[model samples]
Target: MSERINDIMNEEPKRGRSAFQPLIYAILVVLGVYIGSNFSGNSTFTHRPAASENPNKLVNIINKIDEMYVDSVEKKALIEKAINAMLEDLDPHSYYISSEELASVQEPLQGNFEGIGVEFMIQKDTLVVVSPIQGGPSETAGIRAGDRIVEVDGEHIAGIGLTNSKVMEVLKGEKGTKVDLKIQRRGTDDILDFNITRDRIPIYSVVASTMVEPGVGYIKLTRFAKNSYEEFMMGMAKLDEAGAESIIFDLRGNGGGYLHVAIPMVEEFLEDDKLIVYTEGVNSPRSEYRSQRRGRYADKDVVILINSGSASASEIMAGALQDHDRSITVGRRSFGKGLVQDEIPLPDESALRLTVARYYTPTGRSIQRPYGEEIDYDNDYNDRYDSGELYSEEKIELNDSLKFTTPKGRIVYGGGGITPDVFVPIDTIGASWYFSDLSYAGTIRRYGFDYSDSHRDELSSYSDVESFLKGFKVTNVMMEGLFKAGEEDGYERDERAIAESGEVMKIRLKAHMAKNLFGDEAYYRALLEDDNVYDAALEVARNYKDYAIVDGELTLLSATEVEEAMTTN
Candidate 1:
């Protein structure tokens, strides 16, 4: 009976083992099938491996060397070099502003900065103060003309490789900061030290605003800064108060500034809801700016003056007014700069003013001239000159690929600057190499300043411009001194040319002297006594019909009548 029971147990054990083995094998097979399916799925979704390392692997290698190499490398210096290299490939206007150079570069365009305001020039390796800005810290601190800056903040600045930018850096600081400056005056042997508490120096955009003729106002804008619109409005109000019937907005050498300032200035001429300008770009949304109801000179006859340097916002104002037939644009073709640059701030306190959008006129004309692949902006104006477009009447060819018409059906060109209604050729008759050398060598300014100083008492007696003009004389003595100075500087004076240019040179010298002594208004008041362009604009303003014809619109006067009126006027 024991043997039979043991046999049954062994058979039972065998049967249990076989059942468990089969179950385990089935579980293993299922697990293996699941694993295979997951592997196949992952293979289908995964990316392929690269055959070689990335092209920018050198950058990574350099970074590793900078981090863990035995020898130390200046990472900041490398970054500045890289930044300069990057900017070199961009446009000429696109420049890298180092941390130390940012403020001085932006001061003029911003209209104000903290400093002792003085315009200066370098002469004979010495810093010569040209003129102190009116009501500025330098004037307040008793810094006068003919003072030479020898030291700033205890550092010897004279006879060193001190640049204009470096001088600005040393002179300008936050308001309430004191700067110690050592100045050498012309009459004094001992150096004069001035401890000036820097204050906010106002940079003017509107250089002059005066009555050019009876009932005709003139305002010369040097730039469109932050306070430009306000300054312009003030000028207009002053002119209106003086019974000005027409206005001439001069934008001759204005390279332009804030668009916000420009739009409102154009609004002063246009009515409400009139399109001023529009911008478009790939990454930027289309933006359209229209005139609002807050205009001051909406009912006045306006003439805008432009030249080769009048660019960006100036072009916008001129184009908007021309497209709407609100004003007649005079002078030369404007500098084409219809692209919007946005100042993008970086982590290192540096900024990137990248061109983000292209601007268009109300008539849908794009004023952006072609840029080469290498972006040589120096040849831009020269190309215009070479094409004979600046001074010729070769139909003023427009790119048909980008032409548009104004609301009044006037043909407008595109892919270039705002074409003036009346083109004025540059006055180059007296621009001989001798004249250029004298102008460039500071001979004009130096002689003018010296003459003004010697005759200050007598010159100050004439309170009015007309009286002063008649009283002050650029005599033979002054001319002789100027000629001698020019000769000493290796500039040979052309006898006939000098005689021919005498009138213009004398007038400009007197004007510069007046500016240094009195103000910008006085200078312009003296200079405009014989400006041909201003006279032409005044004539246009005197006749509304002539103005309308030039603005590409038919008027009450016929072509014959207009010609007769122009002849008579």
Candidate 2:
């Protein structure tokens, strides 16, 4: 739901990248632009034809190239490359989108897209259905998990060097359009066929919601999409139903999406008319977005999880709440993204996403990291890593010139990413070179999918996540097989290394298997067994006041201050 700015961005490399990497790379690409879902509507002026065919500098140059080049040139490709160069020079965030790339770039953030609605993977030259998206056309049409898609529309797609793009080209179509698929099911002698009509399959932003503990609800929001506010509300309702007294809002690695989506989403946590965030730029006037109503969970303790991958709307959500001292933000500093973008449609369907404004937190904090004019914008992450910022909150550089104070008199700094109230350094407790080597060879994913696929009959016995957690265990035999897989991948077994990393490996193996068998929630539940940031959030949520910044220090508020904050909120 976040990080993909253009449809075909790093297309091949994207196949193996975690869903979290896009936002970081994307924010780095665009700087800090968050183009709203209603992109075309945000155009400040209509794209008009010039008096002459070749008017602008670039266009005139393109015309000259077309007129006198030694060989024929692709005018469209030329124009796109020129546009890319232009945007790359402007800032990190401003960029152009080709018409073909526009829809796919916006699909995940728009909340839905037309597709066959089966999550798939290209394994060993065959397209296998990982799971049918719930209530999707493929699911409704009876496509089952582990079904091998042999042919599409009578054309053999399997064993034909299939790529994600190739699969998308064939499977995704206009709603109500039927596509024929020949499938090879397990234990079935005959090939089965399913004619599935494509439909609007939802791309969920709230990836997981669960009662991590009694009276504690944890919602992992991956991005702020068009439906994210509604999705978050649904999550909150579920947690409330489960008797959750506190909330752990996990926005870790969330790259961010629609700005409007973020505003309303954060409005769910603030008092009426409280300044949530504001925007200002030289060309764009100052615009303030205030909370419209008293939020539903104003009095409930909230803990926000953030990290270097959290940017734009993720920063917005974290910054606003942190400014109000409404939540205890934990983990590393946020991905600094303070710019706002407005999408302008060009003469063609392609559009220009131009940065128009800079967003500021209520405390007047600019969460934009410095860039341009000798600044190594791309190397900022590396600099942070080298400077020990990830390992120590004290290492985060803050500017006193940009210092601001929250209404509660808590001193906060600006001009960098949001610094968490409680910091959880990168966990190195179980890290070792051996574990790194084992992980480098795809042992976890390979073992997980292969095991799940082979033991489907046994895994299907667990009716729910709770039962699976209780019933499933990574036995010694499974560990041996996993180690053997690592060895096959060229990682030699070091007894000391295995001793150090074996438990962590089991947790990952179990999580991946749970994800493949059950769903995303199960995967997160399995990994929560060893998550440091999550553990911090849980502890802080239960005793948030112990870490609350009152008078710029972690101290319990007096009875009068507590009553005032309660009344004000």
Candidate 3:
């Protein structure tokens, strides 16, 4: 048997070994191989063929270690490690997912999860309800926003070092299962107890949508999940009913999901058969995704909002619109994540989410940035800040080699993410260490919940978001209470600092309160009414034709007619 095993393992060492070789050698040393002593005349040495005609050198080494080493080892674990190491040699986006993590990984993108739906946050060592999902099990069971959950299943969960994962473990379970909760309401004397039946709660991709102005609509898509297109269309339908002539499509912080979903959403803005995006790679041939169906929103003026957090499908949609001169993109340059990952399921129920292709815009520009160390790629946003790219358009450089002309003869550059036509610098005014410390300690969120709880009856009186937005104002008493909470949380009470951050804090707190009472729509309506990015986009929409694509950038046309001059020439 040993001799037969030796025959299976005898492969010559290849030139230039990979980075994983040393680790494989270490694993071999740690887990020595053991051969059975019961090798008799009846015992047959089964010689199985390698996975491929050209057997993997790494696999051969691992097999040799398993068969010839002196002690017992988990060959499965070693194989998983080897697979992970091999993928690291490829692009940063290419990664290995374990069987244990596969379900959790798919849950968000699938747009539904089994749980008693109540969005929560750990505030002051307690599980505070940010908001109950409308019509969800929690909300149906009388779980109001700002209610503090003290116990789960009669177990004392709060003030016992509870974490987000621990809370999820206690709350989330099989559908139709019961989970009891003991709540602490601000005004209630006794702890409120309720039993919530777990059910399939929808995870919405479009968090907020409303009419920002009479003729303009504001729709914020949180991600490009499976049902994102449906949610977006529903929102648009409502906007259309409200007489919307223009749309402010907010894609800020929407780290993308399904490409299929995004393509259809992009189609809504484009004409029939227009090339929205195309993908190609060494392995993947050029496949162009075009607008196939006639869209209802074809003639509507569009403005897309993006930031450093917006990526993948977000970039695809934005780039396509910009290249076609269909919309004005506002905000900072987007997060450059143009790689298209294809999830290949392994035999062990795990998955290999490998970067199979690079997506390009209509003008053929790749939005993917150069990848180095994984940490560096993750910290690229901070690097942008350090390099002054986040605050100034001049700091953002375009690669001349990657220049491509749109159909309208406007130049656009590739080599990185989608650069917005109008750049809104990050607001740093009134940002102090005092404000930072308080925010870091979750003081702002906690204060909002506390204030909402106390003012629920008064706040609940407002029937419409517009009425609430115009009528409500943060009082001195509420400000003092927020400041007191900050002080209690070890954040010093600097009256001058608080005054400096007063306006932002007031608006943000009011937004949070609105979110607690109504939903994300009210929250955004309150917050974005004064947001700089939204303001910029609104400005562009107000004077839509005054601005035109010139050279490679967005420029305002002079009062002296250039198009008339060109016609004469």
Give the lDDT ranking, best first: 2, 3, 1
Can you tell me which runs of candidate 2 are displaced by over 4 Å?
A: 1-61, 432-442, 487-496, 548-551, 555-569
Q: Write the per-residue lDDT of candidate 2 for residues 1-569, one digit (tens) a residue.
A: 12222111111111223433432343332221112212345444324445653224433443566688677867566545545655666777787778988888778778999989998888778999888998899889898878999999989998889999999999998999999999999889899989888999999989888998888999998877889999999989899899988899998878878788888778888889989889898997898989999998887788899988888889988999989878778899887888887766654677767788899999889888888869877677899999998888788898889888887777777887888878889998778887787666667777787788889998889998889888899998998888888788788888887788889988989998998888878888899899999998888777766454656755556667777877888
Q: Could you tell which candidate, 1 or 3, scores higher by TM-score?
A: 3
For model 1, how does the per-residue alpha-carbon lDDT over 1-569 read when each residue is reduced to its tens digit?
00000000000011122323432332332222332333344331133325663424433544564688566757555444444444444533444455665665567667898888888877666787878888898998898876899999899988997788788789888899999999998767898989998899899989888887788899999877778888998999999999987898888778777777788899988888999999888887998999978567888888888877888888888889888888877777777777776654444555545566788899988887666565555566786778776677454666778766677766667787888776666666455667777888888877777777666666778787656766777777778788887887788878987877777777777887887667678788777755766666777777744544434433446688778887888
- Per-residue lDDT tens digits for candidate 3, residues 1-569, read 11000000011111234654665545432221211112222222122344653324434555777788677657666655655555666766676678987778777778888999999989768998888997799989989888899988878988888898898899999999998899988778999989999999899988887887788888999887778889999999999999888899999888777788888899998889999989898998998999998778989999999998888888888999989888888999988888887776655577667777888899889988888655566678789999999889999978989988877777778988888888899988767788788777778877887788777888888888888899999988888888899889888789888878888888878887887777888888888755889899888777766676666667867666557645667
Clashing residue pairs in candidate 2 (N, C-alpha, C atoms within 3 angstroms)? 30-92, 30-93, 31-92, 31-93
What's model 1's lDDT at 552?
Answer: 43
Off by over 4 Å in 3: 1-21, 24-60, 63-81, 182-193, 373-375, 558-569
TM-scores for candidates 1 onward, in order:
0.80, 0.87, 0.85
* Model 1 residue 358 lDDT score: 81
Off by over 4 Å in 1: 1-95, 123-126, 147-166, 180-194, 374-377, 529-532, 549-569
Candidate 1 has its poorest 10 consecutive residues by lDDT at 1-10
Best by TM-score: 2
Model 3 pairs in collision = 32-69, 32-70, 32-71, 33-68, 33-69, 33-70
